[model samples]
Target: MFRARSRTGATFLALAALVVSACSSGSSTSSASSPAAQAAELAALPEATPSALAPYYGQKLRWRSCGVPGFECTTLRAPLDYARTDAGDVRLAVARKKATGPGKRLGSLLVNPGGPGGSAIGYLQSYAGIGYPAQVRARYDMVAVDPRGVARSEPVECLDGRKMDAYTLTDVTPDDQREVDGLVDAYKGFAEGCGADAPELLRHVSTVDAARDMDILRAALGDRKLTYVGASYGTFLGATYAGLYPKRVGRLVLDGAMDPTLPARRLNLEQTAGFETAFKAFAKDCVRQAGCPLGGRGTRPEQAGRNLKAFFDKLDAKPLPTGDADGRRLTESLAATGVIAAMYDEAAWQQLREALTAAMKKNDGAGLLVLSDGYYEREADGRYSNLMYANAAVNCLDLPPAFGTPEDVRKSLPTFEKASPVFGEALAWAALNCAYWPVAATGEPHRIEARGAAPIVVVGTTRDPATPYRWAQSLSRQLSSGRLLTYDGDGHTAYGRGSECIDRTINTYLVRGTPPTDGKRCS
Candidate 1:
């Protein structure tokens, strides 16, 4: 299934497995510096970022009234390939809802709720612009700029709706050689479509480039430094920004933070295990309810997982009708994606239980189809958004493919299986998507030492599924002035997801320029 780099109000963060060690490894990462030292380092950097990037920083943004009330939209232009400025420019879409003030203005609070593909502007308009706490909203302007190749920013589309439907139904957990070949062919086809659709742009959507674009946006907005809250994959983006322009980092909140050092394989494995953790939590709660689909009463969570696996197997042998009108059936891959999508947010657990009951007991796959469709941004009208396409484009370009081929995946099977016995096989195969990527990778796994930045708050949900808690810990330790904010909870992200304590702590940092105590714990 097309992995949905989900929207704002949603994501995945895992509870990272700790690697205990006693001694310092080397010299690259040292101890934290005081705020004064950090600021001095930041200011000591050149006023002009680089001789090559002068045009980008000097470019102007012409904002005009557009879309919803109290908001303004603007078009930002940046070099399509920073190295080849003579080649052309890429247009970026930006939107901002100025603060409704009772409190003094606090420049801007740029918000990105994850997804290399998630629409930042959409998040600002639908959620952050209005849903944020009034006191914070009253001061900081809620701003979002769609990263290059995202929604409203010349998005990259791979497969059409019909082709995407088939791709999603393609069996990922191949049982035989034929199924394995089919899966490989599907991956090849997807990569080919993406290349054909945006051959030039596809190669340029790497996270590092996107970080550079954010810096240009910062200058265009007339903000000397950037203040941002980035969740899930957005954490990686923000961290990249800090790494690129530590001197320009004002206050960054990396919630559901990603560890920049880990390679793709480990990240996938950890995230798979995170899904299992979330599933167990869902299972424990499901058993207490009446008519629990997987199990009831004293049923163990492992048994529930097995029951779900059995259902997936059945769907694999014979796809269930979803009455999708488009004639799409609920296949094993899509169902797994849907089930895992709910694992990102506990709030969706009840609906997940109901959907499971319908699929497992009532023989209706419609509920599961709805969930899968939502994940892929497939509308009822048989149209699709560019979420999945940009997701792969950016993911594939940011690093080398997770697997080189089906054989490589087979070799990694045991580790993935260990990561999540229930969902491991599909996830292992899912990582193979980038194996057939058309564009060569532009970035690599590296530590983001945002050394000279301000005291950035790193929030880690205890049981986050996409970005693990340990990642937050790792990131906090990496930044020179990073402070850790712990949320003892399950879910992808922490801030504004129902914790008054986290809200207050982060709000204090954003509104008052005060950093929360390092290693501060909040439930």
Candidate 2:
């Protein structure tokens, strides 16, 4: 699967820390409408309180202790299909930590750490609720809701642990017609399983549907406007919400933003190049460190990539034993995912080096396997999280498949290869997974202007692996009230990643509602 994994909560970093112990591993401004004017316009809009959704909006949340010391959890009821009120409701899981309050309270500040499938409530309970800037937490209640078809919210299950293991091991860089057929079958089976599991829910899991759910959550929370911070794919969700309810946007920070105007193929190709860029950064730093498996001190980045690609080729022929209790081995696909997972954060570069060294020199694939499992959210007991299943469910429904057939993938190979020789082939083929989707896409490429929304901040990291920086530029340009904040660094997202400048800018915006100047650049 093509994953734009969240970096906001450092969930993967915590997972990477475990892997290192195991293997020595390591928005824009065309609108011109003032806040008061927007508020007036919002008050006059009838869609804000449509009778069809009144029951949902009027429902009150009954929060109770949720095992976590300082948090409360509740369930939110939203129509499974917003277009059809008679349809049954989908109960969404919501969690919050009330404001600590040394300062006056700000309304609830909702957060989502990407994944399309990532658990927002889990992110809040694990990191954001406790780890966000203390001043911000003191004023605003930290809240998160697991969107429909996500963790703790009637998740989409495609395959069991055993079947998922087989699917992840399927060769992505196919060399023969037989191998290609095998890859296609894996995708088909995965999609078929989802359809069988939840045919109705699968169709309603698009980004737009999730955005509408957010509005309902806002109403339930008793907030007149939404105050949010979304990362990676979550940026798309925030943008969608702003577009749908422009006047209700309040202090939104879309970090690691994605361009809504690009088609699936273009997005995949750009993301392929993004991984290549991140890999080159890793390679350059790796050669400077001791015990670097790819090269010594004077190795060129291109040469380092070539060396790593050669190792993957070797794995393709002879998989390495991972010592997994389930008898799983480290295939090329798994190893690549491991490497790509590390590219999300530069802190994981050391872990990547350790994993590669263990795989290449010590002949132990355990380290790389650990990293891959973290990417897939696979637990020690061989149980799989619904992350990947929901990821495919939402992605396939949001946009048309990148490839219509295996032949399409083959034809796109050269272009994908030109994007990134090391990862292009596998990613291009991976894009084909959506082609076998059981449901057709309900959305297409389009700009989200959010014409009269309040000022929104968009942050971008120059060498982000999954969401390219150019996407941030494009999205910022498309939003009427967007401000671009560039971080000249490597990683997936900017805020809460140790950049004081980036964090301070966003913290001030979230706390004081003072957005950074348009085109602000932070190192």
Name the top TM-score candidate: 2
In model 2, the runs with Cα more than 4 Å from the true position are 1-46
Model 1 misplacement above 4 A: 1-47
What is the C-alpha lDDT profile of model 2 across 1-523, one tens digit per residue?
2344463111221111111101010011112322222221111133548888899999999999999999999999999997898989899999999999898999999999887778898889888999999999999999999989998999999899998888888888889999999988988998999999999999898888889899989989999999999998889889889988898999999999887766666666677788899999999999998789999999999999999999999999999998989899988988988898899889988888999999999889999999888888899999988877787788778767767788987888888788888988887777676677898888766678888899999998998877889889878887899999999999888889989999999999998889999999989
lDDT (C-alpha, whole model) for all candidates: 0.77, 0.81
Strongest candidate by lDDT: 2
lDDT of 1 by residue, 1-523 (tens): 1121323211111011111000011112212422222321111235466777788889988889986888999999989998888889999999998889987888888888677678899888888899988988999889998888989898998888888777777888899999999988987898899899899999788777788898888888889999999877788789888887888999899888877666566667766777788899989999999999989889999999999999999998988888878888888877886787787789999999998999988888998888777776678888887777777777777766667777877987887788788888877777777667898876666666677788889989888766668779888887888999999998878988989899999988888899899999898
lDDT of 2 at 426: 81
lDDT of 1: 0.77
Candidate 1: the clashing residue pairs are 12-466, 13-464, 13-465, 13-466, 13-467, 14-464, 14-465, 14-467, 14-468
Assess candidate 2 and give its TM-score to the true structure. Answer: 0.93
> lDDT score, residue 36, model 2?
20
lDDT of 1 at 423: 85
